[model samples]
Target: MIPQPTPAAPPRPARILIVDDSAVMRALLRSVVSSDSRLEVAGTASDGASALRVIDSVRPDLILLDVEMPVMDGLSTLRQIRARPTRIPVIMCSSLTQRGAQVTIEALASGASDYVAKPTGQPSREAAVQALAQDLVPKILALTALGSPSHGSARGHASAFPLSSPAAPPRTPVTANLAFSTPPQQPPSGFAPAAVLIGVSTGGPAALDLLLPGLPAAFPLPILIVQHMPELFTKHLAERLDSRCPLRVHEAAEGEPVRPGHIYIAKGDWHMEVSAHSAMPDHHSSSAPVLRLTRQAPENHCRPSVDVLFRTAAAVYSGRLLGVILTGMGHDGLAGSRILRQHGGVLLAQDEPTSAVWGMPGAVAQAGLANRILPLNAIASEILRLSARSQREAPDLRETDPREAGASGIGWVTP
Candidate 1:
């Protein structure tokens, strides 16, 4: 008689350690986490100090760390956790206030994997609750040990959150569009970049800290970033990153001229784009490329969408723009990235294993739009390698039609 094939073993539940001073918050987190069978509340701690004490014993694969605890707050705890021999991923819990934003930025810089905003003053409690659940649970599943699939899920939002106690983890989704290899011909012989555009979300702050330090201060291109964030948080994140990196990083100012060797971060809720014409004499040209900010309607449900900046820059910079899609939770950068590629721009993605959530990069990779698929560490060097050979004078910025230069008529909410 022919024997039936043996079933494969199920993935072990992701062990999570919850640390919060408030008993209620800890309980709430536990309830949400334990409700999913794929996750297990490995242990709980009242504060960072207690967490440090029990951390080794519980041996959790991920941590849900709270920002403000009485003794040894989240940032301090994060430093200690990072210093440990074993690298356990920690997600911080943060308040949505300005002060909270500042501290949360610090936590991310301190090496916490990612963060979740605690519902503070939203108009409806249920709305806030649902937001919290939707935001926190999926992130936990994606960033935890449980989230790393042997193959990448094209869109983590769709299949990441598992409700049933299935015997096995679901296979990662694959799509025809994901880019597999660097385009054989792009970044053509005489390529020189006028600017570098980056789109990141989910685990961006920490990812930036790790990635940015690898590039030198003398790096030639002015790097612009669209990190999914709200007001106050983007400013704080830029401040935190600037202090650590050799390069100068700042939150993008509406009228500021783009300059080499500096990084401009997109301000929260505003679409940061480049003006084809710089009204005043500037470093790069007689008329410099200017920074423009608008409150355009959200793309991929994100304001300051990666596509907006990338698509606009493609018009202004021609083939001189380098588009990079880092770790993020959605496909925000894909369509915009396509526009850049069509215009001869070179696109790069952070490979799946190194990314906190491969959603955004995966989208680009699956679409076969990325010119290069790189790990976080190698991207900086690749930037340097590509920029060193870039053309000295940018293509006529005026070549693109004036109509594409302005994002004026689109619906935008007042900040």
Candidate 2:
């Protein structure tokens, strides 16, 4: 009898480098990464310094880093890695504690790719292990397999696609592909806009890093952003964007008048709302909308939720608002975009492949809410085209030259 033929061996799993101070953390991370057949832990390091030392040998495609460590912190390690020529994506594991959240934000600004809040052992905490698998695994899978054709489908592992945000059982299946097959296209016309409101989460930091820098220095209208992050991280992101982009970027402050030629990032841990003053009673009042910060209960399990900001902006700006839903893991901006549509506003979404996770944008795209869906590279230029038509015919409002707005330099207002 002829011998039976054997099946070919499976492809090598994506190698992962685990870096953390705690042995338990490293072990847990390893288990999570290895849970799938397509991923395996390549090496372990107790600190950033040690991780750096072994990077050459391990030659990992991805790194799971702990934010705090005795010998070398995550941020310092990230900085050293960024200085090198090789480009490897890093995911940081940070605790929900104030300090942990803040430091994690700094790491993102310092060039870390993404982050996940460390699950706590307390009974009151969410399931740490489950959250890690659901959140971290998908990110690793997506980032490592970025341009691979086999992405976005169930590939024998949970990390093969972007997972749902906030750590829960997925409400829907992942997309089949994240790419745009056609060339970048222009959006519809006839609508004029006063301001830009963007709602993003999960993959926001890196997406914004790519987008904000691409806009022209003379880009009109202030851009209001709601990125689901801890307080310190939001502030750091604004600072980082300010340095990189032509637009003056800063954290949204209470009573600050939203203006043209600037970008206002919603402060972390606070729900950002747009409240019209109709010309405030104070002498400092302007016709522009006033920034309102509140400690309202979290929506969609987040304080500075995309829903909160988008809803209020829809109400305040009405048909004059321009809302864009970028990459995120949840449907936070869906309802808000619906409101924008109700008021005759324009909304755009980032296409799938460019998004780290297509949840937010997909939500709008699937619902038929987005007026136009463009690739990540195309969205920046579309913003200019969509808004410029109205801007050209726009009537000038009250303004005093700060000298900064005249140029592409940074602008600041004291609270």
Q: In terms of TM-score, which candidate is strongest?
A: 1
* Model 2 regions more than 4 Å off: 1-16, 27-43, 49-62, 68-89, 95-103, 109-111, 118-188, 278-284, 398-415
Tens-digit lDDT track for model 1 on 96-210? Answer: 7888899998777655667888866657645555667777877777766455442234222211111111332344333334445544345666667788999998778867887
lDDT of 1: 0.76
Deviation from native of the Cα of residue 214 in model 2, angstroms = 3.2
Give the range of the ten consecutive residues with the poorest summed lDDT in model 1. Answer: 156-165
List pairs with backbone clashes in candidate 2.
178-353
Residue 394, model 1, lDDT: 38
User: How does each model score on TM-score?
Assistant: 0.79, 0.72
Best by lDDT: 1
Q: Which segments of model 1 are wrong by more than 4 Å?
A: 1-12, 122-127, 145-186, 277-286, 391-415
Deviation of model 1 at 168, angstroms: 23
Instruction: Quantify all predictions' global Cα lDDT against the true fold.
Output: 0.76, 0.74
